[model samples]
Target: MKIMVGLGNPGKQYEHTRHNVGFDVIEELSRRFNIPLDQSKLKGLYGIGFYKGEKVLLLKPLTYMNLSGESIRAVMDYYDIGLEDLLVIYDDLDLPVGKIRLRQKGSAGGHNGIKSTVAHLGTQAFNRIRIGIDRPQNGMSVPDYVLGKFHKEEQLQIQDVVQKSADACEACLERPFIQVMNDFNQ
Candidate 1:
């Protein structure tokens, strides 16, 4: 079994915000595969789908961003999934918009959710799919920026990124995480 966890805050206000890109990717995958993430268990909203003959669990942590680790830990523990069987999707402010970084292991690089997750899992070596949201200008608070919606011009590009991230997720499920990372993280 494989678990793909997308981290984001849940609610109307979080829609289309930079912080919610991971959620958007999961939503895209759900739509593409026609699998509704209406089931609630393991402390999250998730759906079980088959990808290439393997059962894939798609999870959107509903505990919001700060305490997102709870959902991840709960799902993994309940299913007895190893850390290697997990792939976390999240937004990254350090990278430019439209870029992606899929890493096998790394530090959170200042992401609070990832930081909390590292604390819970006792490792920085889990697989991660980092979707770039771009950094805000000088004097702009990161939290505020990430919590805000994108401009009209940025919307289409963001949508494209979301869809591509979904494809990357599928690719990871088909093969190894490194193959997807090497292909997408260029």
Candidate 2:
């Protein structure tokens, strides 16, 4: 089975914020594949279903961003999932808005969610999809900017990227992750 996790804070207040883009992508995937996130367990909301003949579990960690790894570890242990079968989706401050990057393994790069994930998982080797939110502009504080909602003009781009991210996840179910990265990271 393949596990796809999207990291973000839970609650309506954080919805649609830049930091919650990962959740947005997961929601898109849920909509596309008809996988309802109806189960609340292992510190997350998740659902299991078949996608392209592969068993897939889509998860949104409900422990918020910083403690995301706790939930992930619980689920992983319960399902006996390995690092190679995991795909994490989260926001990236370094990339421009609407852009997505895929990496098989790397450092956390100062992302608290990823840092926590690496700490709990005891390794940095895992599949990841990073959706770019860009760096804060106009001297805004990083936290405020990440927790802020996108400008109206950027909504279209956000929609496009969310759909694209979901598409990449679907592709990964059928093809090697590296191939999906090569095709989507452009």
Candidate 3:
């Protein structure tokens, strides 16, 4: 089974914020794959279904961004999933808005959610899809910027990237992650 995890905080207040882009991608995947996130367990909202003849579990951790690993670890342990079967989607401050990057493994790059994930998982080797949110402008604090909603113009870009990210996830189900990265990381 393959598990796709999107990192973000829970609650309506965090919805659609830059920091919650990961959740947005997961929602897109859920819709595209016809997977309903109807289960609340292992500290997350998840749906299990088959995609391209492969078992897929779509998860959005309810433990919030910083403690995402707690939920992910529980689910991994319960399902006996290995690092190779995991794909994590999250936002990146370094890339421009609407851009997406895929990496097979790397450091968290100062992302708290990923830091927590690495802490619990005890490794940095895992697939990751990073949707770029860009860094803060106008001297805004990182936290404030990440928690803020996207501008109207940026929303269009975000929509496109969400679709692209979901597409990448679907492709990963059928092909090797490295191939998907090569195709989508452009």
* Local distance difference test, each candidate: 0.88, 0.94, 0.95
Model 1 lDDT tens row, 58-172: 8999888988899899888988999989989999998888888889889989998898789889899999989999999878998899999988888888988898899898898
* Candidate order (TM-score): 3, 2, 1
Better of 1 and 3 by TM-score: 3
- Using alpha carbons, what is the TM-score of model 1? 0.96
In angstroms, the error of model 2 at 146 is 0.4
| TM-score between model 2 and native | 0.98
Candidate 2 clashing pairs, residues 3+ apart or interchain:
none
lDDT of 3 by residue, 16-45 (tens): 999999999899989988999999999999
TM-score of each: 0.96, 0.98, 0.99
Which model, 1 or 2, shows the larger lDDT?
2
Q: 41-138 in candidate 2: lDDT tens per residue?
A: 89999999888788999999999899999999999999999999999999999999989999999999989999999999999999999999999989
Tell me how candidate 1 scores on lDDT.
0.88
